[model samples]
Target chain A: MSTGSAPPILETKALTRSFSGFTAVNSVDLTIGEGTVHALVGPNGAGKTTLFNLLTGFLTPSSGTIHFQGRDITGMDPERIVPLGLARSFQITSLFEQMSLLEHLELALASGTGLTRKFWKSVKVLGRFHDRGMQHLEEVGLADRANQAAGSLSYGQKRALELALALALEPKLLLLDEPTAGMGLEDVDRTIELIQRLRHGRTVVFVDHNMHVVGSLADEVTVLQSGQILAQGTYDAVRADERVITAYLGESHA
Target chain B: MSEHLVGTSHLETAATAAPERRERAWARPLYLLLALLLACALPWFIYPPIALDILCWGLFAISVDLLLGYTGLLSFGHAAFWGSSAYITGIVAIETGMPFPVAILLGALAAMVIAVPTGWLAVRSTGIYFAMVTLAFAQMLYFVANRASGLTGGENGLQGIPRPFFGMELIETEAFYFYYAALPLIILGCFIAWRTVHSPFGRVLLAIRDNPARARALGFDVEGYKIVVFVISAGIAGVAGGVFSSGHGFASLNDLMWTTSGKAVLITVLGGIGTLWGAMVGSGILVTLEDYLTTLGFEGIGIVTGTMFIVIVLLFRRGIWGSVQQAWHWALGKARLRWG
Candidate 1:
């Protein structure tokens, strides 16, 4: 996070999203520094996922401005925002069941590069772009399973594919909502390694219930509680906050 | 180990191993040559009229499969686009001396125009709801075609459709040029479908169809991709319908019916929803079956097709092409195991 010495790459200003009478996400401002692994931690139903959804354009904010690289992107479609160097991965491994694992990466690579459609005689000629897809797959240690149907992959392998797809976006900022959810212990370690490696290219905002993951990776942490920011600062700083402990971790040496 | 080699590389693995990209480029046309053979040569061995019918429906299946297989939108209203184009082609060619190709182009354009609005509405709904909305809209078109006796000639259909061009006049029924002329267009149509399936955008369409949220989060315009596929597929289907009307010297409300739409769906399912070659196979089998049923004077081909659809859905979700591919992979795996 440049020791908090530079301007934020992504910032939320009074962002709020409401459905009918219920407000799932409330107006709460936060700044995520450039190249920082910003951890968003909260107990269940604490609006962590909702805030992720709003930020990534899955859900539009009802009020407030969202700035990415100093550009206002309050209510842009998730699809439109992807090319602007903002990409996300789902908590679940949302992938094509029928296609090869490599094909998934290829699609993501094509998308991230804005090569939406090419009416050429042979798509195989675009091997340069295809090579990048292979690189992404290799980064996740899935070069071997490149051709295997993604659906046939084990749960952990699918999670790797999900991460690979997000990375293929080549985004300036990445929002990962529960990236490690439902993964085995071994998978958690692999995914953590993948996230750590990704920090070289872009900032990552990841949510996880696992405090160990949060403490190990988060450059700074923001603790959410009941649709509001309970505490924010370094992992230790948020961990020591009385309000964070009382509201979320229940104060018993948590 | 064999599984790893054969795994997914069966489709385009050669491209990966090739040292020169230009050397690998020539391989693309071989697939087209084979498709041309199927469309052009096969009719010589079969009844010309029947072969022509298969070509028409094969084109239609390819069109529908482009959207359903590629984009993952199980559209039921493609018949609205197809049937409307037929009516336009039939009415125009008969009323004027416009060439058949020009009329067909008009039909395709009409379908694309309709597709944008319908696709816009359908894209908002996901999964089964999207399928239902498309079906409802198509049925609405079916009603309009059936009621518009003045233009479309209603249930009885418009007669005296002309097949202009093809070097002098040719009979719509026994025209040998149907095989020669229509065959090229049919091959070209299949080529478009083939290219789209293998292209970069085609890959993204499959990805979005598979996982919209993931595709979107990866920076893809999922909605835009779906709409684009829908419009393209609808336009292709319209051209197929135009070919059908001009070839038969008739256009009717029957073309716009729900049953007609279901026929294309049946072909897509039977062939393999996602596989391009499988679509032609599906179209061939379904068209042949319907023709046999007609000759037998069997009143309800629907009963048979409906049962087959249910059986395919339950027992073989991959359809014909998918199952064949699966079997081929299984065979390949077994062979490799034996070698080991």
Candidate 2:
């Protein structure tokens, strides 16, 4: 998808974050090209999620510069970053449990349309966006359950709904953290398909432990171990890297 | 095949979906009209002064509901708005000789001014902490009102606050139709409160209440929204306070008492939190009970009221009016599932 001459759309320069004296994310420079899906892979506690949080502005970096399309966005609030064409789905499902699936979609649609502050207007008047919300739900195959409570959805359905929410923003860059966690084989396949279909013309950075998913879907892969990048290349290249084999796969095996 | 967008709107389809649903919609407005009619007739049935007191308390309870029922913030300092406005309105009316509406506006404005900073600081902590913070602020106001004898008339309070008659000091004549005079303002305040709860802003407040972190993640300025709603709620309380001071002919230290805030909370909870009209119902019941009990020389009436509140809360989780609506929906849904 990249012409190879253009600069990376998102870049982190020696980003580091520490909590109380424990460095969750150490100095790591990551780059993601335009219109490509990049996978962040590591064993547990490798700081993949912390890296995602830093990029998404959920957590401020202890020290580092994060740039999106070459503009600095190191400490921007998640709300501010979202409108800048960057959206994210959480590692754990972040949802309004009491709200219906349609209501969830409506809120995302409302946020995208900048209608959240419209206090005088009834949300029923937002009927114009109802079809659009349904369409997004359809994308995730949750259309039939639109009226069902979000909390009532099965674990896999919740994950699908979470993706649908991020997609509702129609963002240029989507950061997905463990998008397939807790999903069954069929649900994971559907989720992967949905992500694949939606990845066109968008820059995606995702973290997953599933090597098969990373191997098949990622245009590039960055492997991390102990809060540092162990390898970065095409999936096959990174998978074949000797240090990766020793530090990551070898460790997992042992 | 392309998905059909369900061409008709939700309300448009309601007629075909269920006759009961259609009737229920119509019944809501009809019920409201009847309630309004009853409210209009209340002065004839009860002493006008007691009815007027109920209307004032209704407004105050609605203000509390705007935060507690809708936004999910339990404020223990609501009297800070109510009492501050009572004092300000009385003082302004007595000293400045301002028109009734002007005095009310000034009082409401003063409430908004206090709400902004206190709401700003209080919204930082939620639940019990928020309640404590608001209570602390209200206590501060009470102390100030107690000490400021020159301005607030201290323990004696601002007594004999003369109600204006078209900018004329005809306190004697003006007292005759005080309920009728205050009715329009109360109606206007209720209408505005009703409009606000049904507004898009109100929906966000509900979402924030349900899940603040999720609301924040969805790009809502939760703290900022809280402050705005707090100020609005305070302004509404101020309106109630203004009416009370003018109607009762005094602004006393009792207005600033923490128990006043507790009463507003109790009234709201009793009617049904989040039900805008329920506040009025709660206030009406509470005020009427107080009036009847006091007239019969019933002492320690708080015990009776407290026991009733516990029974109501335990039996009807949604409060009186809300429980009725919930039960109706449950029955309707059950019937539809079984027979329809």
Colliding residue pairs in candidate 1: none
True contacts kept of each: 0.47, 0.33
Candidate 2 structure quality by residue, lDDT tens digits, B200-300: 67777878988776676676778888998999899999999998999888999999999999999999989999888888888889999998999999998
For model 1, the superposed segments whose C-alpha errors exceed 4 Å read A1-3, A119-121, A183-194, A249-254, B1-35, B146-148, B171-173, B332-340
The positional error of residue A12 in candidate 1, measured at the CA in angstroms, is: 1.7
- Which TM-score does chain B of candidate 2 obtain? 0.89
Choose the strongest candidate by TM-score.
Answer: 2
Give a tens-digit lDDT track for model 1, residues B1-340: 2111122223434323312213236655885677667667776776777888888887898888887877877887778887888889888888886878888778878988988989999999987888898888889988888777888888789898887774454544455666576665666677677777777777777777777877777777778878888888888888888888878888888888777887888899888887877878887888888888989999998888788888988888999889987897678667868997
TM-score of each: 0.88, 0.89
Model 2 C-alpha lDDT per residue in residues A1-254, reported as the tens digit of each score: 22255368998999999989888889999888888899999889999999988988889999989999989999998778887888888888878776788888888788746566666676676567799999998877778778766766667777888888888888889999999887666656667777888898898989998887888799889989888988888887887788888876576653
Error of 2 at B320 (Å): 2.0
lDDT of 2 at A152: 66
Lowest summed lDDT across 10 adjacent residues in model 1 chain B is found at B1-10
**TM-score, chain A, per candidate?**
0.93, 0.94
